[model samples]
Target chain A: MLARPAAEKGLNNYMNDMFAFDETDRKIVEQLRRNGRATNQQIAESLNLIASTVSTRIRRMEEAGMLRVVAVSDFAVHGYHILIHLAVQVSGRPALEVAEDLAVFPEVFAAHLVTGSYEISLLLTLRDIDELPPLITGTFAKVPGIKSMTPAVGLDIVRYALDTGPVDSRSAA
Target chain B: MSRPELDDLDRQLIGILAQDARVSNRKIASDLGVNEGTVRGRIKRLQQEKLIAFTALTGMKLEKAANIAFMAIQADTAHVRRIARDIADIPLVKAVMIMLGPFNVMATCLYHDLDDLHRLASGRILEVEGVTHVETSLVVKTVKISNRVVRITDADTLSQG
Candidate 1:
């Protein structure tokens, strides 16, 4: 328990120090979030900065593993119809192990080793609502050390954004 | 909803753009054995169809020393949708969904630390009118996070393979 948080803090400290992701980077990212195709000249013009600085910062952030501009596909518009959240209780095995094992499945979108009543939390995408039954009973039942699973099928997804925050002093809590 | 299938060239273009959305269309066109106009036109059509979006997705843990959490909520059955929307509007919440099963509503949120997560669950989410029970879980480790909802048609499926 003590070791993980300490390791996390140390790693985060290194990351924060390794890259100075400041106000300018945030502004730059905001612009890109709005339009990823925006030219460096355009971003520089909008932000009132030198085009070289815009280019330099973007290159720096991307190289340092601090940013990624990805082309994301829509979920519902394609064939995937159902999304479910599952709170899993584990016994006899480390939660991370199970979480990692579960991660390989294409349907498991996000798997987390968690702290609470349940040991692991999962987000799943499915072809149809009916997939839930066979998945829970037939598939998940086969995985070792899964004591029980409490699942909630998403009837309507109000929001599905994952790139949450680079929360700092200005945006903390 | 019926939609046109993405051809091999289309998927290949998308794959390159997926890696670097900022890549020049001219660069992509040359690599794909097509003209810059063709590349631009396809990207425009894909965007207009709402099939793809270009955005900067942040690495939260590295970016802000933030953590992720999920809140499972029990809400008034009649007003579940309303309550879910309310939770969605709150800060820190990345996603919210009205659900069916043991809990009626679920949310995924990011926090600077456990305190922020605790505050979000008890202070923000619970205070919503229709919420009854709110069970919060803090993510200790993130195994995977993805949103690969791409559709593969039979044409590209065989050709690409």
Candidate 2:
């Protein structure tokens, strides 16, 4: 209880110290977010910065681990028809251990050790609804932990993003 | 939705781009021991197919010093879809997933500070119409977050291996 908030604060401090981004960096990131394959010249033209500057800023930000330009694939288009959120309540075993174990499965898109009713929460992409039972009974059986699990099948994903912010703060930048 | 399968070359290109989206076509082609024309052509085809998208993904935790909250909402079933969209429009809500289970709506929200999260929960999220129950779980740590399959198991098997 005491440790979690403390850790959050420590994270804030670390981010402030090492990960702070200026206006230019934020704008570059925004442009890239719109189009990851955007060339430096294009970004510079759009942002009214020099091409060299854009490239330099990108390199700096990448080194700082503040941003990543990646290819995002749509699971639904590829026949992964079902996406489920699982909240697992752990009894005796550690929650992080369980999360790490579940992380190995290819279906798991994201896993988190959370603070609330459930210990470990997961976002899984499955081929079909039929895969659910075997995945839990067979795959999860290998993971040693005794507790309850709740599965929520996603009907419509209204909004899902791998990275959520900088909050359209190009004005500030 | 019928789509063309990604061959070995396509998967290799995607895997490489996933690591560094800004890598040049020439560089990638050289690394993969393929011609630049083939690499360039495949990337264009991949984009046209909408199988993959190159975008900027910020590490919110590191960039904003933010705390992400996972909120589960119990809402009236009749207006579930509308309610989910409304909540998604609210500031700081990154994801709003309409679900079938105990909770009808779920969202992953980001807050710059704890006060923002408090205001969101007590001030806005709870006040939304038809929202009967709002359960939030603060993400203490993110163990894994990947948008696509980091490892392509069997290109032939749609199961993602």
Candidate 3:
């Protein structure tokens, strides 16, 4: 597990301190869940409200730092055939610095400071198996303060989602 | 596509929907303490504005399948699109994208093993016109994967202001 960053402590505290949501907020969110790209007009029609009012609500939600919209590609359709996950252990530098360095690599899809034997976890895409040796021996090992690395390739993705379903009312109860 | 304007309420709504995509409009209205009609209106507007999009998430664990490889190709700028389209037609190719920096094209494919990967790279991928270089990385493991974007909603706001 990676050690939690000091800045994260403040962010986590803030999240915990946040209050609950009311009904309209929940409805707006549900519509977004179904289609992040759904038009404001369509949402208005679905929920039956004026366009500008819906726009205001969306603006408010954005200001609160709840969610975002982005283009998502099916990597499978692309030429990247190999997906490699690397759990890297670092010794000298701060984990965040290492994460920043790893992020510079275009092949690296995602990097996280996680909790476990490793300090950083990386998601990467590559063209073939031959590229692995160079990445491990050349790119990663060269990073200062890097101690060790463990990699786990995904064999099958059973179930995964960007968002964990709505906060259960039962959990609050 | 351009990013959209969003406020605090919009952020809250997105967060809620991110958690559960299936919640009803009535339920959402009830949770946010607003008229159901109002909730419905906002959702339509967000969709029309292209602020968010939804698609089924599908993934396969390549390690268990016995074959996996990453194919990087360098192609002439003019022909990159054509090459990408050709590669996409292959059955084993799972994903393809244009990248920045050293490489021009990055693709992921699934196969039986080393022999299978070799055949695809040499025969199918390399065969594409204008492909200058091909580099393959056999995935060892997957550490983390998520389609979520950071600051997608607010990053634009800060920039605009």
Q: What is the C-alpha RMSD of each candidate to the true structure, in Å?
A: 9.2, 9.3, 15.9
Model 1: TM-score for chain B = 0.79
lDDT of 3 by residue, B1-161 (tens): 22356676666565565444445778888999888887778766654454443421212320223344566568787877777767766766655555543556666566776677778889889888888888776654433334532112321211110
Off by over 4 Å in 3: A1-173, B58-68, B85-95, B110-120, B149-161
TM-scores of all models? 0.82, 0.79, 0.44
Candidate 1 CAPRI classification by DockQ = acceptable
Candidate 1, residue A39: CA error in Å?
0.6
lDDT of 2 by residue, A1-173 (tens): 01124564355445744656667777788788777889999989998888878876676566555666777665643567788999999888988888999998977878988999889989988877888889989998889873988989888877665464332222100
Q: lDDT of each structure?
A: 0.73, 0.73, 0.55
Q: After superposition, how far is residue A17 of candidate 2 from its true place, in Å?
A: 6.7
Residues A68-173, model 1: lDDT tens digits: 7766566634556777888889999888888888888877877888888889889898887787788778877778988888878778877666653331112100
lDDT of 2: 0.73
> Chain A TM-score per candidate?
0.80, 0.78, 0.69
What does fnat come to for each candidate?
Answer: 0.68, 0.65, 0.07
Q: Which stretches of candidate 2 lie over 4 Å from their true place?
A: A1-19, A164-173, B1-9, B26-45, B148-161
Ordered by TM-score, highest first, the candidates read: 1, 2, 3
What does candidate 2 score on TM? 0.79
